[model samples]
Target: MSYRVSVTTIEKFRRYMTEASTFDTEESLLDSIKGFFLGNDKTKFGEAWGKIIEEGHKFKHVSGNLNGYLVDGIFFSEELARPAVEFAAAHPKMIYEVPVAKEYEVNGMTILVSGRTDGIEGNITRDTKCKFRTPDFQEYVDSYQWRFYLDMLNAKTFYYDVFEVQGFDSLVYDKKGIAWLHDINIIPYEPLYCSSYSDMHDDCKLLLRQFFEYIEEKNLYQFLKPYKSNA
Candidate 1:
């Protein structure tokens, strides 16, 4: 079966997937958005969320408690270290940072995307969630988070680290056995890529347009529904 994605969604997906940009404040976000809209920059919500979620996998707890924060710090540090270490581990010839840059194109409206990766070459591209069941890796298809980084760098495999956090005395059920496990779970994900950025962007834009149309239709229906009811 075929799926439909939009440029706006792809924009959002790419932002969501690319694993860089660690600004955790409202002001910085506002500044980034202003820059993107004004053409001063391109690191908007789409790309930011993509990368944010991607790195978020390393974090185990969605609850944001003390333990979670500890793990988060470790994860963030690891994310920073992954690129440098991976390069060092794989190729003794050269070392590089995770490529972080913006790509721009003029297709009627300006299209900008950020490229930040952990440089874990030959790894899977995936997102993490706080759920028991593993999510379908395909969910990141039009995700502005993953696609942006994957597209910008042309990565063949991606990973999602969905983590389930339990207390120190929680029991786990698995095919092997039912035993008490620690407070963290790790799930890795991989997605398939076929189209180019331009193609993905077109799909994202279409979805955004359709989303606006749906909102308008819903609002109109609500407005008319009351009138028809009175009649």
Candidate 2:
């Protein structure tokens, strides 16, 4: 039986497993980790924000994407959507939410990776990353996205359109916890992900293999989400 998953889920599992200390308890971490396989994502704000931005490419900020979003109402959500919206407008040719998929053979196990690209303008693929703090460009260079997307598209250049958001107005923290603002792009790299392009296949295979073994050891197979084919 082949397994189907998204790069999103794969990375989520790896992150939670390796950074287990971040969660409050082992059970909490396990639940959180399992939630990924159960088709649950905890980053609602980020997800909604991304959706709102994509809405811009098509010139709309529908309600569901902004539900309970910003305190200033839909206006804030619209505000958050502005930068990328403007960028895409300027680029004018980029397509948002483009689907791409690939299959991999990991230790005789077939695993399929499938997902949508955030934006693709010509040969350059782009993804928007929203950050609460000032972003270090290096972080963008190190993400799994660019390489994965690059391989899927067979494009050499990738972009990380980054947006730096500010914290809410506050009294205690020395930082001006205030008013606010953030721009973005998917113009895209990373250290561990620094392996050469030719090594990408091997790197991905190893990751999927390790991921398979990790889940097997943790006995998480039962929680795996049902992809259309897998279902």
Candidate 3:
């Protein structure tokens, strides 16, 4: 049977390769690794912010009440949405929530990689990230997610639109004790044209093949267990 995986999953496997021994069983380890892709509070807020930005970009030409178009009320407050909205207004050409997917054959196994990019404009693909502190641009460049997006989209440039919203006075952060203002910065890095692009692609494929082999070997034991549970 063919296995479906995403770039995020591949990245998680790479990260937890050495730490899998921490889990009690292979099934538990797999479940915990899968949890990395699940939505959490931080990701939820980032999605909300991205939605507000997309809405603002879509309706930038319209006049009158923009608040009605923006995401507001309990979930998304004015403070949190303001900068994203403002940024969207400034750059109206950005296409939001673009879905990109592609399948590859690695070591005789079908690997399906897919992701929804935050935005894409011209030859550049952009990902909006909200964080409590400034992020390292090199980390973004080195990330498997970014590399996958670049390869799938065939994009020339990749930009990380990082919104450092540490000090925004919102109810979301009332008790968290984060009170230092930060700025939104767009850090652009060229991926496809990089000197190490070919090498990186080779490394990713090898890592993925190793992951699939490990999973298949582990699952074989489950199938060959002596006793089966009736419950």
Q: Which pairs of residues collide in model 3?
A: none
lDDT of 1 by residue, 1-231 (tens): 112222333343234334323422434333333333342111221222234333434343332332221121222233332432342344343212254433333232223333444334444433323334444445445355555555555554554443322232233345544222344333333324433454654554554444335334545223211111111
Q: Which stretches of candidate 1 lie over 4 Å from their true place?
A: 1-97, 106-109, 122-138, 167-198, 204-231
**Ranked by TM-score, top first:** 2, 3, 1
lDDT of 2 by residue, 1-231 (tens): 576767766655555556623543446546644663342222433555566555543334344555222321222445555665566566677788899988777766666777788877887777776665556666555456666677766777776766665652221222433222223222212212222388776776777788788778889767765434432
The Cα RMSD in angstroms, rounded to one decimal, for candidate 3 relative to the true structure is: 8.4
Give the per-residue lDDT of model 3 (tens digit) for 65-131. Answer: 3232223222333444566667778778988788897666777655667678888888778777776
Is 1 or 3 the stronger prediction by lDDT?
3
Report how far residue 4 has shifted in candidate 3, in Å.
1.8
In model 2, how large is the Cα lDDT of residue 227? Answer: 37
What TM-score do all the candidates reach, one by one?
0.35, 0.68, 0.66
Stretches of model 2 off by over 4 angstroms after superposition: 17-33, 36-44, 57-73, 77-82, 169-196, 225-231
User: lDDT, candidate 2, residue 212?
Assistant: 83
